[model samples]
Target: MSQAAPGKSHREGISLIELTEMFPDEASATAWFEQMVWPKGKRHCPRCGCTETRKASATSGLPYYCSGCKRAFSVRIGTALERSKVPLRKWVFAIYLEMTSLKGVSSMKLHRDLKVTQKTAWFMLHRIREAWSTESASLFNGPVEVDEMYVGGRRKNMSNAKRRELKDTGRGAVGKVAVVGAKDRATKQVKAKVVESTDRATLHGFVADAAAPGATVYTDEAVAYEGMPFPHETVKHSVSEYVRDMAHTNGIESLWSMFKRAYNGTYHHLSEKHLNRYIAEYAGKHNLRNFDTINQMAAVAAGMVGKRLMYRDLIA
Candidate 1:
């Protein structure tokens, strides 16, 4: 067993103490967020995109008065943090916790640490995950590993009534949800999503969306991945042939492993309706693994612009 070198984990990036020192107060946190979101130092109206905005003197919440739209808006407008009652400082702390954790941070832990209600913590987590969701069209250029996993526990472990509701009479992944993933070997970036099925069309669609044409793709012996446009290779897992030189789905398999552990340990029970959000959260963390704490936080904050999630919309 190989052990990590001493201070290996602590060597890179800002420590928790440094984070605390950097943002000692609410004003400091606000300033940091402002700098990240408005890097050009010109405050534009998020609604109208007007640069003719002035600071509101009476409002202590850093509200900006937009002369173009004649509306008063805060820095949180049009972002994931819009209309949120939670303080900016607490939001920063929650982002820090979410980014720093290797597996994930649960809403229960966030509730305890930030002194917020469980429901609020849960909402906060989902909104932050909204910030992490990527709209990038960039595809994996090099060797890409693709795989699928069934989320949720065994049907045999469910109660009789629950099993009956799901009609999960058969064994092995009958009631679980399917998620497809691809990992780029060169960039070490990952992209994953919840799929309705692991059929040929669905699997191929994911591969088409994630991988560039002419990229080498690796997977386990799944018939669904047989006829992709890219160069495809497979290892027969059922025949105990896990790896074939450079051809293996190990990278995607490792992603599923970490995702499963986080799901089982931290979240425990996940609704099928919201499973995609959870997938985005884990994938985002995996994609941003190389960034430091501040840079990670900045990256997420950058994603916040022009994205908003309402409570009603989230539930409905």
Candidate 2:
């Protein structure tokens, strides 16, 4: 990635015109991707990890041939972009648009902007999300805020049959997917997942995995978070006590607020089956919020390696 200061606007990095000038042709975009995927000017065969390679036939779409694997491969192989027909330049543009947009880039908007089919645009967005999907190896050191949110359509908007089926389920958060999240105050990075339940075991397991030992954990007075292994504190939100001393879930709650805004205002509806991918996208982007737009784009490109999201598998 480029060595640049972190900022949101184009002033911190390349503007649209600058980006266009930087990648005027397919070859230029390909070189940039190669730089990100294989930094330090070292390119290896993705198949066999061999350093020996040579130019492929002119008729072959693949640019290089791996002598060890005896196969031709491009940078797209073994990545979320594998088997994609979209041009690399358009992919770069899509990435820039995806990163720059705080909420997210919708398939319709992306299709319109890139002159691609809506279905292709939708798949492209999901592929980018898959590329950003990652698990932080290090645990949060201290003052981690934990919270859960329900994502789904409103009861009023649901069909009568669906409403009737969920009538006995419960009132608030019924017929909705529960997502638990933790935000590290020090790093300002968040990790979250679409959980099957918000029970004690589930919530506790999440906190235990996310927070390091002896780390301070903050949460609302939820029964699930009653017994935490780490040094824990609670703010009684039920009685309108949000903050007491250094205890508050405001950070995680704010993350939920932003996610909900994107959910409602941008995508409008996120299917439960793929809700986790959307969560990963939001959380990943949130973690990279401070980086320059170009750097953020490079990060996504770097993450593309070792990930492959086939259209068949995605729909399945």
Candidate 3:
């Protein structure tokens, strides 16, 4: 693997060698985590936001002690990594791997690389994905392309017994889940979610949540999108009209292509329960593709704060 440039910052480039060199031990990783979590280089109590804190002891697992709150804490207190027994170095490496992998790093790959159990690796991956979740109150502005894609196996591909068990709705998407996506043409940002149905109400609700009012919306000739709140345009896929002068859902379609590739190639079987997290993982990467490794890591790290996902909560 190529090494990062000497004297260059971590955000510029991060390779395996650079990662190892930068964080050779737990102390280095802890210090770096503290810096990232508290940018001003001062440790504060997560409970009460008190700055009056000191190291608990030389060898304590809970590193910091807060005088105001009378509690012990660490950098992991309120973040996704909270209560995790995995070392800081491994967490750092996992963060780097998650951000750097284009398609996504599998739990098995993380297991082998990080030398953790497959179960632990799986949990760690989910916690890291929790950090990638982004919430924005602002709607997607500009010419937005909206589309829906079905995710699941085809009826013909299933065994005879399984086929008999499933109802033949006479539709291709009979047993598949629907994922609606919206892509901004100008910003190249994507927002997607798993929806129960692709009817007019569902599609319109997704469009309203994603796009601003009066925004130009482009989609295929789907009747569900007929009365969209935005200035709508359509390209009839059934009539071989894929594009008509900057009016097409190709942008969002490309996002679906990427998502399908990752789903089929990397994560072969995704449970419907955790499908939203998977969508968020891919959508976060799609939105932050323009940034370098460091900034991307920083962005993921920034989301780590104020979120906690426990193992029981995850499993439940």
Which numbered prediction scores highest in TM-score against the true structure? Answer: 2
**How does model 1 fare in lDDT?**
0.85
Number of backbone-clashing residue pairs for each candidate, in the order shown: 0, 0, 1
Mark the regions of model 2 whose C-alpha exceeds 4 Å error after superposition: 2-11, 159-170
Native-to-model Cα distance after best TM-score fit, residue 259 in candidate 2, in Å: 1.2
Q: By TM-score, highest first, what's the ranking?
A: 2, 1, 3
Candidate closest to the true structure, highest lDDT: 2
In candidate 3 the C-alpha lDDT for residue 36 amounts to: 81
Candidate 1, which ten residues in sequence have the lowest lDDT sum? 1-10
Whole-model alpha-carbon lDDT for candidate 2: 0.88
Per-prediction TM-score to the true structure, in the order listed: 0.91, 0.94, 0.90
lDDT of each: 0.85, 0.88, 0.84
Against the correct fold, how does model 1 do in TM-score? 0.91
lDDT of 1 by residue, 1-316 (tens): 1222233364257777888898899999998888778886877888999999997767545578888988888878888998899989999999999888877899999999999999999999999999766646799997999998999867668888877766655445567899999999998889999999999999999999999999999999888888788998999998999899999988888889998888878888899989998898888877776665677788888788888888998889
Clashing pairs in model 3, backbone N/Cα/C closer than 3 A: 11-294
